[model samples]
Target: MKEMTGLVNTKNKNKLPGDGVVGKTCNNVCNNKTFIYTRKSALTLLKTAGILLLVLVLLAAFTACVSRSNQEVGDTGTGTGTESSSGTGRETGGDQGDVQGAGSKDAGEFPLTVTDANGVEVKIEKKPQKIVSLTLSTDEMLLSLVDKGRIAAVSYLSVDPGQSNVAEEVKDLQKTGLEVESLIAMQPDLIIVADWSDQNAIKQLRDAKITVYALKTPSSINQVKDAVMTVAQLVGEKGKGQEIIQWMDGKLKAVEEKVKTLEDNQKLRVLSYNNFFCTHGIGTTFDDITKHAGVINLAAEQGMVMWQEISKEKIVELNPDAIFLPAWSYEGFDAEEFAGSLKNDKSLAGINAIKNNRVFCLPEAHLGTTSQNIVLGVEDMARAVYPGLFE
Candidate 1:
């Protein structure tokens, strides 16, 4: 049997503040000036007023009670989830996703609630066994945390060794496109997509009740660690997540110690170059790596807060201390040819990196990564900036 509660109308229609029984009674009492108020008449009037006051107080209390009850449990007919005082979902357990530090709860517990990068709270009734990765970063993070069997598919980018750190392991998994229909066909229990993925596809996937983790691009080492840890918690691999973070921290601390002895002026001014003259600016993973590696990003120095292409004239003017070419190892790309072109460009002839032959082509796997391997990118950069210190 379903239980039901109806709203109580507590307004007292019979009693008003002015112009009624009280008015008539007062008029009659005052009209007879010779009739002085005996104790009996005065007590009768007091009793009448006291009864009206009691009715008003009772109505006010009842109204307040009803409002508070409604606020606590929103429209009960609808199945909308409730939020606690902290804004975390009022599920059996506190928000599993927002949990920090090493988790103590059994991750295998059913009906888990997690807050994704999009700030949407997702509830998983059971552990996700079949996962699909829609981005290269998530592909690498997943492979590092879960078993190969758990990963049903990975993005097409993950199949290319030039663009993915886990390409070797994910080469056998089926590759997926960034289409809603394609994702639906996979019937994934969980899907990990980037924050910038197609909104239409994300909406369609969510409409189909597919659990999607819209992971964001990390701007710093701490954010990278947090991303990895968040995924680990989602995939029931918190231990593996902690291990990866610890490893990254060890590598980063080594670089920090090496750069600790260097003076501020001694830090190298560097620029990251793709095939085109484009580079990442402030609030980017590459920019953060440059900071950790004890080098200044020339693009950031120019007040570029996002990825932008610079004119050849500007490149010559900046004359970076070292030039990092991250795309030199892409399948058919010829590193030597690119280097020759940089050296021969008349506009870039006066650049310090070209003059000193310090243009370095870093391995694409680590250099372009925003995942845990970013620590490797930081280490490689630090080595290039201060060659003898790393050796």
Candidate 2:
């Protein structure tokens, strides 16, 4: 495990006037008012009345000044005042200043209550300044919805080029495993984890009174969009989350338009396979990708459910029109080499994908993505299946 570092340092420069100060000032004004009202004799009473009026005017003016000063201090402290249309706020510190400002806008009322993927309602008292993401999907979404400085840490997979879309963006951020102690040390205001994260770890964090939001594992494009919106809402960036969804919709719309031109006969039967003979099936994001790309998924058609392993004979029998392999290597298993082996296997020569040379190595970052970047997977499959359509 990498040592936890890069935690954001937030320093509030301006302090609001304390209640004691205001209380003392009010006490002085009231004491003078009482003294003036107690004056005896007609002339003294008239003079005291005039002084009383002046004192009241000064007190009101002083109270208004204090109120305005307190408001300014609050606005400066939260970095939410005078937000620009670009969604940025006053710089707070180094690179984090811009990021802090970006996330401060469009934040709906605090003391927010929402249910998590686990069906547990969690309440947030204020906008979270320090956030930690335990899932790669949430890691990707957070980078887009908030400032990088606001993120205390992300998952270890987020820095892996083969498995993450925002690997480069999160290189400088701290990485964490499921260690409860490390998360506690970060002092995060909120922690985002996948529904599949270890229940024991989550329990421990919750026991420590940390705010942990468990997001459902997105198995389809629509589910992915929902996760994005949920994360944005959790972090007070719903507008940015909507913008990301729109961007995804816009790209998907273009792909759908192009795919509409393909006739039923022209649509290719595609299969995504890994070295372990594991392939995605119905109810998986890959299945959703195939549907949107206008391609027939061989695994779904063969009555497969989630990720399942099949024998080599099944691949031969399915005889997909195009086979999508991952463009990544892990645990000594190389996808490019697997693709080569598939092409050279004489026993599999009868397969259409092999004979037609339609075997492709799609980026695992996109193919396995559960974020807005899943549209890239859709476009990759669509373009690979019908090269001429994209051209």
Candidate 3:
């Protein structure tokens, strides 16, 4: 091969005019013998032809490679790769089928089987025309990712403007409970229930052959983002899931950049207070929100976990740098009066937060959320804790 390649290179050089290679070779051949000149010329022609053939082969191979790449990109539409589903030669697009996210994928066209948070595989033969959401989190997620007309019902809590972020949007939808009877009557094409939902209800729904997927409560921001993607995947709206994730990512990045000036020691100690006189602690979504907002959760530090109730004395002892109260607590009452009462409360009067008037009423929907909208909660808290940074 090496010898042949060298010969091809020599012939190529001889073909170029003014190289003197061909002239020198022809002179040597003519001086030796006239008969040998014809033979040398024939050999030179064969070498030149071989080089041309190799060049054509290389060009053809390159062209073929480029064409294949273009064809793949064109066929897939999304440059991401496709995977073949089991037994079906039909191509099921993976991350490439939809916008990229934690939960976006084309699980194949119809009779799609999706594995839920519980690792249970649920199959859907067609696009769900009617869907029922059993939790406020699912209500908001479904509303954001799916058409309103397809929603057969939402959790009763979703109708209360104070409890749901999409309360206004869900008001027209049927308000229902997770009772087996109600769910059976709705005849939902798909039912979304929480991991904490009643096992009996889930059993009844499954017994009826209704497609029900249980969504796990997201304890962290990443899990929350994944939840959004999961719901989007179940509803066959992976693109919407990606959009939700992107929106959350943008807000999170903005909050992160805005808080760069604040040192770790500068983070404000914060606590979330609810109507039940409890505070959010470790393993709760509120803790995730405070951490993302560049604040330390006081309750979590005090060894509280998962909505633990604290006495008034503990409130003074912890004396968070800032107190976040749900805005819905002001319902049927004056906001100014509510804020003033907390400010003047004898027990909390000595607290630094109350003394400095740093108590803020966070939106009910934003504070209690465990979905993509939790980004809104993080943003609200960040702005409240560090107003100067936002400005």
Candidate 4:
């Protein structure tokens, strides 16, 4: 889940103290009070959790991003049964199209043909067989594309039932810990990392010449679809990837249709806050989803995508029509904590959403990963953004 930090509007200097309103329950593994002892220090880069999912999946955290040029092969397979892997489309359809028959990319099934993101050429002898997934989402994505026999080791965190999809598969692996040596020993073919921030781990694996695919964070839905397809191809599970994309697309359309039916005047002005009371602003996936939901994002209005620390005073100034505080308090707090903070704050009474009781809760599961489940979150968002319309 996205872990949030308390913010103080370091970006928007115009906002002052006694701002409009809110305090989120502390998502720190430790319980922190209103004025907890805070130590200010630069955060050294650690491994990227879900890359974007780890940060923005909830309210408290913000996602960090950088770029990369990965090897790529052409998006071939002319939808012909004669192709090496064909009919990888879903029968029910997805946001992209076709889902069924997208698995069975077993080890050594196909020769490894590495394609750089910039369309550069790199050739390899064999496709990745034993893969290690970095985050919960990547592991889930891998599971969807291939079988458990293929995965060498998944992230240790994947055992956190709240965050992981294949809880059963990862349950035993967690006890072992996700150590580097353990991964190297499992050594079969390749290791896939979620974010480039994992360069240290990737470098260690690369020294052994294990094919490491560094996946860049995706901002838009299409990027998600493309990423899945790329990973699928790499694993020789393009069919499985197609199925996943199809599911996502189907959900997107359902969400869009629901959004279109809302009253024209009911365009919700929304804000997404996490357990840390920090808001998700612009350039984040949650913000993109809010936009896609046909609701106006209060954070976007203030130019906050990836959590800009702002005071309650600033929120009052924005005075959004509605507030959407996702419950990413993986630290054991309730989902309603942030919304309650907004509703109960005396100073926040001046804000429009509070006065109107327009704050609503979003489902944690939908908001968290949604690799095979983006549609579920979108549907929940549509319902939350417009309550009565869904029924």
Candidate 5:
């Protein structure tokens, strides 16, 4: 995020002390020993006294104005008295004193600016009343952070129970397409997209004068939290974001505490396998999940990065203790059938997972989630790998 700058000057004009005071002196005198008080001199003295009194009043007003300005700036800039659910001081926004529009006092500061995943400095003029989500991840975060009435539309995937955790909640909401014309028709005040979204589409949206924020896809749990917080800040739901993170933390902490009881030899070697022979490796969220679940990811242990396909020969050689499959099925793929095939494969029969019937199908929503729900994936994997300990 880029640092915000500039000061907010609430008052239109301010005058310094003695700014308009006219300087005058009395000239009449009776003698050197004693000053004589003529009517003219007395009038001049009275005028001088009046000017001094006015100056004093102006000075006091100026001081009060300065103090008030300082307090306002401090309140907005310092994020004072605000802390995350974890008991850490929260940074509201850096130098947001320059913001110029109305914002919900309870939600967040607005007329806010932030650097998006694309490294562009995007400025939001005010709290968005109509928001559009272009990706399932953003869709998930939006549902949890803001009211449904504030959302104009969400991605089509948001209605697919197989792919979305909040499918039921968002089923009644409008599902949007990626077409520029459809997006423009919605007249959204803000549009949130993933980094992988069509750049040409994003450009078209911006060219049409729509506010769009592109978020980076998270590859790890920490990155997921960052994405969640970023969305929360954009939507004036920082507190809600913190709450989601705290919930994730609490769940993960419980799993960690239980995993601590496992000895080194008790930890299992696990592999996340999809129907396509694809597996998540190092630098992927699955790798982080495996680590937290007290299991070794065979793909990551072999120095793989991101999603990649492994050869059947390699799978046989690696011989994982347990295998995880996606719980959801797509158009042509069936998860249960895939698990059955894995169990019946003659070559893979020697594999420990197959022989021991340790093949598990985890919910696709939890396994591939980029939201706070990913913690559920961690807990699921932990339970599947060490059912005895978890029970």
Candidate 6:
């Protein structure tokens, strides 16, 4: 029966056996003040346990919500967060991995795929942040394209004068040759080599799962632009490469136009020779440059890639109108002074090129590097041969 004044019956005799009860002595806590005291100390323990259980459940629910939020961020690669949870001993559906920052292309973007000049399929992982250059020429090209800080290592000879331009920038990276240990230690995202010549090195790097690419080095001008463009396409900088090519094409067209105006009587005969009096043979890049400059290359009779002694009589007989000698520093040869000596020699006095005072010094920076330097060489040759149109 209900108590008078609408109070709850506090007598344990009226309560269920399983209903563990505790009460404060205060009348406010129970129907009668005389029925209980001291918070019904023993029964209070039961309610304390129940209160703790409720709090733990709420905490677990909150943690699960937080973990789900992090999972959303991980999928989007946006917030790049980590989440941990503990509840009911059975957890599911949490993203696990390191957070990859958004690349220049897009967030979670990776694996730039391409087919190289060699017609082999290639793939790059994780937007290469660090690069190691294997050739001296790649070292020069890297100087113009990416930041110096992005270069991890370069070939030893790249720092020498007349070979590389970014010597000061790559001082530390030149400490060791392109050894696998040294290259891997730099943590480079990619390694660029001239060709497949480093098969052993490539195998070692691939065993360790490092990405490497073989860049092309063309023997002639026709292949030069194509090689440079190939590298640009691989690195997602094709737009920049095409722009440079367009500029080169326009420059070449300008030179060709100038040559078109020259009369047959005005065709200059140019003999392009390497150091130690070695001539650039048939189908050399100099042939294209000289032909564009309205000059005839005298070395067309020789074989491809190199030339043997063509006899002093043949040189005198051809009598090129100008001797276009490349300035190079080799064993005991001062490129500039040597070219001057060749021009002033008593034996060469009768040669048409020597008599006409048409000796030219080509920049060593041009022919020494890679395909990119070939463009520079062509420009230099064009300007040196015909300065009026170039200026």
| Pairs with backbone N, CA or C atoms under 3 Å apart (clashes), candidate 2 | none
lDDT of each model, Cα atoms only?
Answer: 0.65, 0.69, 0.66, 0.54, 0.69, 0.53
Query: Candidate 2 vs candidate 3: which has greater TM-score?
Result: 2
TM-score of each: 0.71, 0.72, 0.69, 0.66, 0.75, 0.64
> Over 4 Å off in model 5, which ranges?
1-107
Q: Quick one: ranking by TM-score, best first? A: 5, 2, 1, 3, 4, 6
Error of 4 at 358 (Å): 3.3
Tell me the tens digit of each residue's lDDT in model 1 across 35-65. Answer: 0111122222223345777979866876776
Per-residue lDDT over 1-391 for candidate 4, one digit per residue giving the tens place of the 0 to 100 score: 1111111122321111111112222232112110001111223456556667656553232222211111111112211111221123322222222221212223124554443332222233455657777766566677666656667777765665545545665554433233567667877476656553445766677677666665545555655665676577667765556666666676678668878866657788877666666877777767777766778877877766687777788778888877766654455675545556657889989777777766655444345563544445556666655666666
- True-structure lDDT of candidate 6: 0.53
The count of backbone overlaps in candidate 3 is 0
| RMSD per model, one decimal | 25.9, 19.3, 26.3, 21.6, 22.9, 31.7
Candidate 6 clashing pairs?
none
Who wins the TM-score comparison? 5
- Model 3, 1-391: lDDT tens per residue? 2211211223122110011111111111212100011112222222344577797986687677667666654444233443322111224432112222122225424446655556565777677879998888888777766667778998988766555666566657898888888789878999988877777878789999899887777888877776776676667765656666666787789888988779888999988775577888999988988888889999998888899998879989988888876565334644345555666789898998887767777665666677666777788778877888866
Off by over 4 Å in 6: 1-110, 114-121, 165-176, 301-309, 387-391
lDDT of 3: 0.66
Off by over 4 Å in 2: 1-107
Using alpha carbons, what is the TM-score of model 4?
0.66
Whichever of 3 and 6 has more lDDT, that candidate is 3
Model 4, position 253, has a per-residue lDDT of 83
